[model samples]
Target: MKRILITGANRGLGLELTRQYLERGDQVFAASRQPDAATELQELQAQYPDHLFPVTLDVTDEASINAAHAAVRAKTDGLEILINNAGIYPGASADEPTNQRLGQLTGQGAIHVMQTNALGPILVSQQFLDLLQNGVKARILSLSSGLGSLTWKSSGDPYHYSASKAALNMYMRSLAAEVGHYGIISVLVDPGWVRTGMGGSGATLPPSDSARGIIRIADQLHTEENGSFLTWQGQPVPW
Candidate 1:
């Protein structure tokens, strides 16, 4: 069975992805910021027993990320797939009645969002580089969003979310270029507007459905696709 690691596994898409992968009999490292309070994930661990492992990971903290990486490395020599799925979108949406503008966005909120959404994945990916390199079919997947597309932003929409994702895309592209020689398949994936905490209530797709599409694309990544920005359904997303 393929071994996979995913962050933010306490809820939503990350939770669903863990369930789906575990159902397929794959080894899953389900990570969350607060594993002790993640009753659902803990229950999953109880059900899967040997198939699922629970880990505590706070991607925003450098020391925490390193510690999590070390714990995983001790248990397994390599991982078949690594999904950097933890992120945050602070404040209300731009269209909301209580929405805050760029000027009104609190310094703390903006910094937290950027650190979690952009810098977190880059540092986490770097920490696990050696583990991925040990796999025969190594793959690194960063859960980006369509809001990150520069082309879409040029059309004017979703400013804060778009800007954060765009920055994430840029970092992923650079990382892919730097690590491609290791035979690792690295790409930034836009999972579409799925129904989750971050995706909000009006989202068209369910988290399970979106995870299905994402896992499909992730499983089929090839060397030629390195540094490519792609959608859940394998479509190219302009960066």
Candidate 2:
């Protein structure tokens, strides 16, 4: 079984991905900001005591990322999959068109969102590179969004969120080139408009469906697929 590490595992898509991974008998390191308070994750830990490891990690903080890496190192010698799923999409309500618009977006809010959604994955991946190198058919999968695609940007106003995800897509593409020599496949996955805290009530896809599709795509990832942006259903998304 593969050893997988999923960030933001407390709720929504991350939690669902953790559940699906454990169900397939893979060892999972479920990292979240508040591990103890994640009731759903705790329940899963109870069910898969031998395979599920709850880890405390704040992707935006370097100290937390280092500490979480240490914790994972203590438990497993290698990690075959690292899903950088921790991210934030903050702005005005989808129904409301207030602060999130072009000129109205706050600099502070945009910076914070960029740090969490784009920079966090890069930092976390760097810390875990060694472990990933030792793994069997290692792959780094960063959760991106269709909103990030410049070609797909038709209409929407989440300025900060969209910009950050676009930046993330670029970073992962660069990382793929850097890590290709090490035989690590780096991919950016756009899990459609999944119904989560960020996706809101109007979203069409459920977390379970998105998670399942993402897992299927990740499992089939190969060197040829590296540095590509794809949907949860394995459709190629324009960069």
Candidate 3:
């Protein structure tokens, strides 16, 4: 069974991924900023007490990420999968003060978006490098968005949101370049426009559809697939 750790595992796609992975008899570290308040994951833990571990992680904060790494390290010598699934869309919340319109971006909003979506994954990966190395066929799969594609860039899109994902892609690519020789695969994936808090209610796909596809693709990854940007269905997405 794969030893997997997923960020933002309390709800939406993260939660779905956690559920599916657990049902298939894998050990899952379901991470959330507020684990006690993650009622859904709490329920899952009750059902699969031995395989499910709730980890408290607030990706935007360095202290929180470090603490999570320490906690995971104490449990096992290795982690086969690290899924960077935590993210936020600035335009979706009025409190964010970030709009899609040109010339309306706030520095505070930009920094918040950048830190949560881009910088957070890098820090988590850095802290877990040793454990990943110790595992068999370790892989880092980061959740990116189609909007992040330079090929898909257009006017009036949410600036900070898209930029942050684009930055994540580049960072993961560089990581793949430096680490593939070590047999650790890293790839950026677009889970598609699934119905979720970030995707909005109008989206076409369900969370299960996206999560299942990701798990299937991740399971089939080889060293040659490192640095690829792919759809949840395993199709190549233009970078």
Q: TM-score of each candidate?
A: 0.93, 0.96, 0.97
Candidate with the greatest lDDT versus the true structure: 2
**Candidate 2 residue-wise lDDT, 178-232, digit = tens:** 9999999999999988888878878999999999998998789979999999999
Off by over 4 Å in 3: 93-97
Index of the highest-TM-score prediction = 3
Worst 10 residues of 3 by lDDT: 92-101
Model 1 C-alpha lDDT per residue in residues 20-139, reported as the tens digit of each score: 999999999888889889999989999999989888899999999999998898789999899989987654354543222544655565566778889999999999999989877888
Give per-residue lDDT, candidate 3, residue 157. Answer: 67
Q: List the residue pairs that clash in candidate 1.
A: none
lDDT of 1: 0.85
What is the alpha-carbon lDDT of model 2 when measured against the actual structure? 0.93
RMSD of each: 2.3, 1.7, 1.2
Pairs in steric clash, model 3? none
Expressed as tens digits, the lDDT of each residue in 18-131 for candidate 3 is 999999999999999999998999999999999999999999888998899889988888999999999999656445555655777777878988999999998898888998
Question: How close to the true structure is residue 93 of candidate 3, measured as C-alpha lDDT?
Answer: 43
Q: How large an RMSD does model 1 have?
A: 2.3
Candidate 3 vs. true structure, TM-score = 0.97
Please say which candidate is ahead in TM-score: 1 or 3.
3
